[model samples]
Target: MALHPTLQAVTERIVARSQPSRAAYLAHLDAARVQGVQRTALSCTNLAHGFAAFPANDKLKLREQKKPSIAIISSYNDMLSAHQPFERFPQIIKDAVRQVDAVAQFAGGVPAMCDGVT
Candidate 1:
């Protein structure tokens, strides 16, 4: 199917506006890949701080860099029925990641307020 002209125009405009920043981001990733850099390269203090709350086994895996760690920032609140279902998302994501030998952490929660209440 052909894209609507309005949608295509908007997409082209967005792409033109983002060209510089996108190119810079790609360049940075290329440089990091060429350097063979990984999060394991962080200083001991920084790494320890990053994994301070992780379980011992997960911490060890992080140090070994054998698996990538994914951070899930949830914005779930029981008071809001719409958002309540998301409370279990972190564990679900963690289980899925574990199946692939990767690790998932509930990094933290973002503050959420109901617009109706405010």
Candidate 2:
């Protein structure tokens, strides 16, 4: 089915507006690919800090740059019951990644505030 004329016009305008930024992003991606993965380019101290909390096996693989690692950043804190369920998400994500032969780490968390409490 054809897109509605109004929708098509809007889409074209968005695409035109985004061209420069899209090209720049693609260029950056190509440059990074040529330079190889980010972790492999890290200095020794930086790499250590990045993998400081990884399990021994994962740390070894990451050090060798032989496997991919996923970082899970969450805004979960005990202060909000809504976010409490996220407490177990890191482990769940780690196990799922392990099944696919990748490593996962709970990179960090941000404090979550409840409007009702404050």
- Residue 1 in candidate 1 has what lDDT? 100
lDDT of 2 at 110: 59
Query: Once all C-alphas are superposed, what RMSD does model 1 give against the true structure?
Result: 3.8
Error of 2 at 53 (Å): 1.4
Worst lDDT run of 10 residues, candidate 1, spans: 109-118
Clashing pairs in 2: none
Residues 18-57, model 1: lDDT tens digits: 9999999999988966765288668889888888987887
- Residue 50, model 2: lDDT of 84
TM-score of each: 0.60, 0.63
Q: Give the TM-score of candidate 2.
A: 0.63
lDDT score, candidate 2: 0.82
Query: Which clashing pairs does model 1 show?
Result: none
> Highest lDDT among the candidates is held by which one?
2
